[model samples]
Target: MTLAETLQTKLGEWKPAGDGRHSWAETFADSGWAVRIEADRTDTLGCQVWEVALDRVGQADASLTLSAWADRIAASVTGLPEKLKVVEIDQHQSAALLRSDTPGSRGNDVLYFEVRLAGLAKASIRRFKSEHAIGARREQIPFIITHEGLAKVVGDIAG
Candidate 1:
């Protein structure tokens, strides 16, 4: 099934906000997180490219030890020894950014996952995509993330 179809089945009864197609959002109050997923474009591989962003709500502080959150997100996405590599990181007293190494690509355009911890106690998770304006793109999407995996990652962030 498509990512949207999967999400629709998983996020049952949650009225989607935003454009409702290419871009949309859902709030999971019980989980203390609001998620937005965008699938408006396609990548060079002709695969439908997408991103999922999750933000913590309320008074919770999103601060974390750089190495800890970095490892958590990286481990959550992959298994065993083959894992997401660290590309770059920018750390400050109140904000930080962590980018993982990109996957191989035919062109210079490549997408990577990122994590952001900001001063306002907000954390963001993103999977970047390099879009191609021309050529044929595939309809079968990649990246199958289980809801359990999401909960574990979000739980780590919330704690």
Candidate 2:
């Protein structure tokens, strides 16, 4: 399934809808939820390259910063509900690279060009509120990026 569809399933009730190039939105209750992923591409020798970094999510989430990543695994799954965990991760060289502690296992890894987010439980959202602030902005819900969508964003032919 595509990223949009995967989000739809994971969210239980939120419907996925696209609003712009690589931008999507969903409606629930009276609020509208959405996210967008944009990557800069450089062409050399007829190949296109893509990248996404933890710094980018840091910029968006406002909880991750140069000083905050001393413990990556803790930070990766921190400040949120217990059930909605950050199961897999993929980071760019620009951002601290996070890999599985268990070796020889490969699946559900995110690449540079995508940010995957998923988690829910109204009470969870309420309890987690007022805890995340990376900059001047505040956030209650985290973005969910899907593994399959990560591949599809940069295209199956390339990373």
If scored against the real structure, what TM-score would every candidate get? Answer: 0.50, 0.23
Against the reference, the lDDT scores of all candidates come to 0.49, 0.26
Instruction: Give the per-residue lDDT digits (tens) of candidate 1, residues 73-142.
Output: 5656442112354444456565556555554343744445566766435666555545444553323223
Clashes of each: 2, 8
Query: Which residue pairs overlap in candidate 2's backbone?
Result: 52-112, 62-134, 116-144, 116-145, 117-143, 117-144, 117-145, 118-144
lDDT of 2 by residue, 1-159 (tens): 443344334333323344322322233221222323232221111111122211111122345432233233333432211212233432432232222222221143221111232211010111112222234232222233343333232221110
Q: Any runs in candidate 2 off by more than 4 Å, and if so which? A: 1-10, 15-64, 70-94, 104-159
Cα lDDT of candidate 2 equals: 0.26
What is the lDDT, from 0 to 100, of the residue 79 in candidate 1?
A: 20
